[model samples]
Target: MADLWTGMVWPVAITVVQILLIVVPLLVAVAYVTYAERKVIGFMQLRQGPMTVGPYGLLQPLADGLKLFVKETVVPSGANRFVFILAPCVTFILALIGWAVIPFGEGMVLADINVGVLYLFAISSLGVYGIIMAGWASNSRYAFLGALRSSAQMVSYEIAIGLIILSVLISAGSLNLSDIVRAQKTVWFFIPHFPMFMIFLASILAETNRHPFDLPEDEATLVTGYNVEYSSMAFALFFLGEYANMILMSGITSVLFLGGWLPPFDIFPFTLIPGPIWFILKICLVLFVFFWARATLPRYRYDQLMRLGWKVFLPASLLWVVLTAGFMVTFDLLPHH
Candidate 1:
């Protein structure tokens, strides 16, 4: 028993270290993503971004965090205090938990479950409940309306997103994200299934409730949306949760379409950079695109948005699924190509 315990100790210690390694960097990245968003949007609009807190505003997120921490929390007089407190916590946890199954490199994952993709879908679906709770708990009309709109929008878009994911899964023949990346070693899925890639990108933006699909928080119409009543650190949690989900979606894009951690080509004898570098680079690029879209595009009308998701993307994704399935069957029928 003593020997067995000794053997297990190192493994447990290593696992803890690994978890820290992923979690710490993820927290830091979430902070910096906000900084990057401001800088990117500022540059796009020809305006100066934050520059005072730190050199070129590098430490601005820290300063902003400190400000939020110092501020007082206020619960609406007629609101359910407990649920108001719990809403942001739930969103933050769900946002962070989705990263557990995402592989950053070869055999580099916190938990590489076989049903990793399904796990992500389920976890993301639960995020809406947090928003709904926040809206209801706040006891405000704007928050309530935002929550209702967000729940409906997320539910509709989620179906299209699931169909798009199904198309990719059909092509890869595995729900494991790492396995999907491996299947794309010869050729990335984006190259062949461009339509699915387009739909996936749109769905992710909708999933994150970013601009054009940002009806829930439309300042002109819905004040500050579900988080309107939240202040101080409580508000910060929801902000962090949104950015974290953005990064998570970007990471998923890397794994599913960009070949998770496989370099452009495994040609060199000794590669200087680690796999995480490529993963980060890809994520940053995707994030930049998100900001770019925000800067360039106008918000879609609610009716048009629903029509595009239901009529356009859903039908397109369904066709792609059938098409991919047929291609797979034909390939299997033919000699190894």
Candidate 2:
């Protein structure tokens, strides 16, 4: 019994505790981010947002979640029940598993893997699986079409994203995210690599299926698209996965460009606050852009989205990578990993 407790139970228990520490706060943040989106977009659209849910609609997410929890989960008679049920689970899980490598602050990551950037990219790329599964399982034309559109879009943007990340990796000279953040101590990557920064931002929007680039589930045509057959908790999981992915993408952007957890100038007012606070603020800034784009821009047609990814972003990012490397090599500015 003593041996079992020491060798097995305790480690498992401790791991669970540590996981809860990250997960609970994360779930809470996810809930409130939904609220923030509604509030921000509503303000942008000149309307009151969720005023009746709680104190200024503060409790709306909780209420909505509960409603979703109780609603009936309907599986189409023609659908593959197994894969239909598994799709959202896959989405929710993959969206979360990537967080393992994310460094929230100095020494604040769950797993400080050397190839953290690669891990994140791989997980993000795999997110297409959930969509494809959902589409095929649903046995609905609209869902299948939406899924195919999303898969193609994600793949296209990912290529540009890969090149942009390669540029950052070349500059940082390491695959570890913490090292990447610390590499920005002298000057944030965005300052020097502003063009790549912009490209990265645009790529992530398409990758995460954000507005203007969200052709997969274009409400006008697809009627909710790939998840059209989902309802109740099934739909809720997809919703959760999307918002979670948004936050994760924002975090990745901050880590890559905004100097994750680093004070702006290490000066009096800037360094006065804790690192995690700066990280959170940067995330909020990025997320606000997500909502802002939704409110301000119109949805793109699938062809336009494809053209932007392949013709515009792909070439631009590729060119910048070569230029960045050449410039660094010529100047002897490339840092050693």
Candidate 3:
């Protein structure tokens, strides 16, 4: 019995440690991603951001987190208490768990599943449920409407995103993320599939409910959207989940299009840096574009957003998938699994 207990407990403990190694730093990164977003936007707008917190505002995220920690969690009088509370937790957990298959460097991933892209797709699709639950539990028409909008938007864009991933998978000849990255050794997928890459970037922006497509939380109409009744840490969880999803999507983009941890070139300077560092730098570059879009782009009209998803991205991505398969077959360019 002791031997059996030790065997089970030891592996469980090690697994817990591995999860912590990924999650703790990811949470910290999520906090600072907010800080970086603010500072980046501040620069784009020619203003200082978070200068007073601690040494160029390095401590601002900590301060913001502490403030949220102490605030009163105001549950709506009519809210379904359990689901209302569970919603943000759902959102945050989904955001974190998607990182399990995201390889930071060669052979550095948690689950390393065969269908890693499918896992990420399913995780992202489930994210909308949290918003829907928040909207329903809040008992607010505005929140419900926001939830409806988000569900429609996310569903529409996910189709296009999935098709785009199919195109990448066709080129890479594997659904395993590490295999996808290794396939890009000859050239990043983005160069060959530039149009698909641009569409993917836009799709992820909508997928994360970020700028130009932030209709779910549109201040003009929805007044704060789905979590309108949430406060304190509940709200913070939703906030953290958004930034985390942004990073996750960027990581997926890095894996699919930019080559997960590959240096741009095999030259001396690029190769000297480690693979994980290259992966991180790629994520940061993608994140900067997220911030830049927020600073520069106008919010799309709801109709325009829907049209782009259905009429533009979906058809384009579907056509690309077909073209990619045909091209690979015609030219014998398919990577051997």
Kindly list the per-residue Cα lDDT of model 2 for residues 46-71, writing each as its tens digit: 99888998799999999999999999
TM match of model 2 to true structure = 0.98
lDDT of 3 by residue, 1-337 (tens): 9999999999999999999999999999999999999999999999998899999999999999999999999998899999999999999999999999999998999898999988988899899999999999999999999999999999999999999999999988888999999999989999999999999999999999999899999998999899788889999999999999999999999999999899999899999999999999999999998999999999999999999999999999999999999999999987664
Of 1 and 3, the candidate ranking higher by TM-score = 3
lDDT of 1: 0.88
Put down candidate 1 lDDT per residue, 2-74, tens digits, no spaces. Answer: 9999899989999889888988998999999999999999999999888898789999999999999999999
Q: Which candidate model has the greater lDDT, 1 or 3?
A: 3
Q: Which pairs of residues have clashing backbones in candidate 2?
A: none
> In what order do the candidates fall by lDDT, top score first?
3, 2, 1
Q: Considering summed lDDT, which 10 consecutive residues are worst modelled in model 1? A: 328-337
lDDT for each candidate structure: 0.88, 0.93, 0.94
Model 1: CA > 4 A from native: 1-11, 269-272, 333-337
